[model samples]
Target: MRIRSLTARVLILATLWSALALVTIAVAISALYRQGVERGFNNLLRAQLYNVVNSVSIGDSDSLTGSPALGDLRFSQPATGWYWLVEPLGNYATAPLASASLGVANLAVPDVEATPFDQNYERYYEMTDDVANHIRVAETEVVLDDQGRAARFRVSGNLQVVEDEIAFFTSRLYAALAVVGIGGLIVNGLAILYGLKPLDRARRALERIRRGEAERIEGDFPSEVQPLANEINALIDSNRRIVERARMQVGNLAHSLKTPIAVLLNEARTLEKNQAEVIATQAEAMQAQVSSYLNRARIAAQRDSVLARTEAQPVMERLARVMRKLNADILFELDVAPDLTFAMEQQDVEEVVGNLLENASRFARTKVVTKAVMTARDDEPTDGRRGWIEVVVEDDGPGLAPDQIGEALKRGRRLDESKPGTGLGLSIVKEISGEYQGSFGLSRAGIGGLRAQLILPAVTKDTA
Candidate 1:
């Protein structure tokens, strides 16, 4: 699996190092076990050699003799890989006396003049004999009080027994180490996941802030990520202050500029007929332009503020009631989800919905319908900040041509001068939706008139 999280990275690095350490310890233990087995095997052979040396005696003719039986039955069996011998050194007038296991074959003792004995008065060697069995031999130079001469006493035991013991120990060791390794890795993985859970909570908190469901990242976090949350909260507050300052400035400027234009229009009434008409027309046009742009500036300034959601269903139902009162001759239909909400101020929703419903009422011959739905983005998962609110309004009057729909959205562009409107209603809706990173479009309705579709960001419980 790909390691994408900090937990996975820590688990992988810790597991690799721990596995190395376990292997090192296992190897050291195996080496010590083998050494212990060898030391014990050699001690047994030395004891047997000392027993044989003590059994020898000197005859009246100054000859050596010993035929004592060892306690082990293997020592009495021929070619059984256990043997002992006591023999005179340098022509002492006596032949060698050996265990029955030696039979007629001589023990393969290495030349000892070139080899020195250890502090225990014994020398040991491992060699293979003509019988094809590997064995350990211990030899000692003995001086008997009953005899005037010295002799060599040697004893042997098979190395195959010690090797079998080591093989058994190694199998058990491998099984034990394997169990420890697997168990350790599982424990380490769980520890890593538990240690990093705070980071996961922080990530979810950030998503809630982006969706505008919350104003700041909440709850306590680990020290490593706490500073990041604080910084993000500071930035959000700073941006809100800046937007508030810009809105105040725009409001003041509109008041200051509109007064002079109002005075000019009033003074135009006292001039000549043609000059009065021109000044009055120009002043009205200026007033329309100023109002349109200033409203757009105010909406833009407040678009990024983290605030409470505005419910769409209440707004739609309220507008439907008012529109019905104004256009008593037309039937108004309303369909909206009660929980549907927009991630913007309530005033913004009222402005956009009111304009669309008013335009529908003006043109519809007999019927108008408004619908608001909470929808999920097709390209995003249905969680957190992936939701949208869509409000659609339709009428049954004469609809616009496909080409005329584009022109209707432009400011001050009216298709029919016969219609009683400034041609700024749809333009205002488009500009407000754009400020919230939303969409607005016109299409032919099923009722034969125009359809205004507005899609904006939505707030959901998961985001909160």
Candidate 2:
């Protein structure tokens, strides 16, 4: 069994959306079901009230024992959830006990403009009971009813019967939501796991790569993520080869320099005191120059050889960690878009930051910051040729002068030449930025220190 890792952010978003969708559907279902039930409830009351109205009349005896013959009054107290009222005067009527709370006596006659004559008897109203439950009504004159002309009958009932039914429906709704909620969570987890199974396999393969067990990101991954894995593996392979080759070449170069280095040492010993001092001085300077060029070659070789689409944040993070390991008391911050990637290779990006950050770390008082952001020029449309990258390297140190900044990027133009730097750091940046068809600028940072902002051309390849 494989477990797929989901991003916490994306997982939260998906779950909320699912819960919202299910809740909306549940509310709509309850609303429609309640509407239908109430409609039927009102209609049943209307028919019952019509019957009682037609059956009533003014009698000489006033005993009120005889039921009206015009309309059928089947039973005196029917078992059906229905009731009726016949009011010869304002407060004279007999209605079911359920109608007491529904204020069966308080119903007002329908006003004209809003409720028409035919719609009067069909209209229903709700009222609360003593225990705060709902009830319904259908009260009107029997004269306009289907039966022959008769007295009026007002129909009413406690909707608790309907309320109880509504409660049952509400319970079922919650039960369904619980079922669907729990089921949906399970399904969501399963779906996320299933969807990411390929990534899990790819992860295992990537682990093999870390341990040198595999050469590339080759796995039985799904098509959606395979390309990413493959590209990463390809980049890893290329980076490894470039580093290994550079290491071997430098080793060979060092070995060849050893003999001349040893010869200069021996020759310096054969000269007079002052001449010997000059020779020794010249020999050390030569060795230092050779070392500087060799170091520059190594850095440039890396930048030139990285030839795969690379992610900047992970690469920068790894590099920043390595730098901190070497120097324990530096605060390194990287503000970068995680998913934003580039066509530049890993080592190439590494070389860009490696030298500059190494230089910044050496000069900074406390903190060094590296930031890479995806941005577009204000004049340029989003999908057009005007988008650019903004890479910033800043340090809180005494700033460089505007005139001195440009002159400092030359191969050997160190501001303080005595300070043991090859001056290849910023030069390499300028060269690489140009090669990438981007612009590089050096200025005073917002924090009153040196800032190097490199704006590169957008990733203009066939990414899709």
Candidate 3:
């Protein structure tokens, strides 16, 4: 899966680049170490060659003579791959002096045409000896007499020893670099997390604004993020102003339209019965339509405001008391926690719960029950806010059948024509619930009566 977090992305990229750089450094260091070892090995062979040259002199027959001590035990052992030789060059006809290690074997010498000597009259090369051992040879020519007679001094040492040493060093180097690379990656990850802490804080602040816990994003953010916070706060203020303007316009429109409808209804009262009845019906329909649309516009504006909240217990109790007084024959029972709160405006909450209670009172024969409780919903996003409040109003009157329940929620379809209502109460409750992203439904109550269930966004007690 792709990493979506900024911290993880930065940490992953840093780890990859650090590992690559460390591997490259390890390789470069290994190469330099190997070069140094080989240079020292060659120097050792050259030093041995010099020792043999110093030990030789032109003897009585004016020819080269003398054996190299070398002081190494391998030189004294036969075919140990460490040896020295002193031989006259270019027809000198002198017997060559060799270390015991050369026993019955001669060191291979490269032809001068193929491998020429340097300005110091010295040359070095690597080859496998007769014993199948890899060896390095350093060769030099020195004049032993005034007659210009020159002899070649050659020294050989095992090449496998230098290679084994370099291999051991490279392995240790890799282990050390691996440890350092892992440590560096851990430090880089921690630094990235610490640096991004401000963004996390900003995220929490925005969540508070979304949940209606705060009116604005508030925190001390880093300079890089402070401007973003300021912009968001400005937008929220602008949105609140827009919602207020929309509410004012809705109120103005309702006032302007209601007066005309009322005037038309009153004017129709003096007409003939047939015309008066037609005019009154049409005017009432127009009034209902205007009220529904205006309510919808007001809800649409207030639903998105970040500062809307209401205490559920107080609103429910107040409405229940009012319903009990209005319907003296019905008993009202309220079940709600004092701390229960909702993320809705007080007016909208009053409108919704008041409608449910009034409808229940009208139909209930003996008792009406109202309840408010906090509940979790699976379909809602799991942000840091508290879950939701469920308000249930049930009445003990003869309820509608399953088929008639759906029709009762229609805008103008009151099932009982004798009941005095515009048939918009339940529909308004549903619309307001929908505007707040809540839910409304009807089901059979345990009290053998109609049950109205309303769910809306809730706030935690601390924030409420």
The alpha-carbon root-mean-square deviation between model 2 and the true structure, to one decimal in Å, is 15.1
* Candidate 2 lDDT (Cα, 0 to 1): 0.65
Q: Which residue runs of candidate 3 sit more than 4 Å off their true CA positions?
A: 61-64, 67-80, 100-104, 110-121, 130-132, 146-149, 255-288, 336-341, 372-389, 458-464
- Residue by residue across 204-272, what tens digits does model 1's lDDT show? 887777566577889998898789889988987887787779778888988899899989998999999
After superposition, candidate 2 runs with Cα above 4 Å error: 1-5, 53-82, 88-116, 119-135, 143-150, 244-464
Question: Judged by lDDT, which candidate is best?
Answer: 3
Error of 1 at 330 (Å): 2.8
lDDT of 3 by residue, 1-464 (tens): 99998987998889889988998999899989999999999999988889888998888987666766778999988877898888888767788888888887888778889889999888988888999888989999887887788888889999888989998999999989999898888888888888898888887887787666688888888899899999999989998998889889988998898889989999999999999989988888778778777877877877766677787877888888888888898899999966776788898899899999999998999999998888878777445454688899999998889999899999877999889877888988998898888999998988999999998888774443
The predicted structure with the larger lDDT, 1 or 2, is 1
Ranking by TM-score: 3, 1, 2
Best by TM-score, which number?
Answer: 3
lDDT of 3: 0.86
Order the numbered candidates by lDDT, best leading. 3, 1, 2
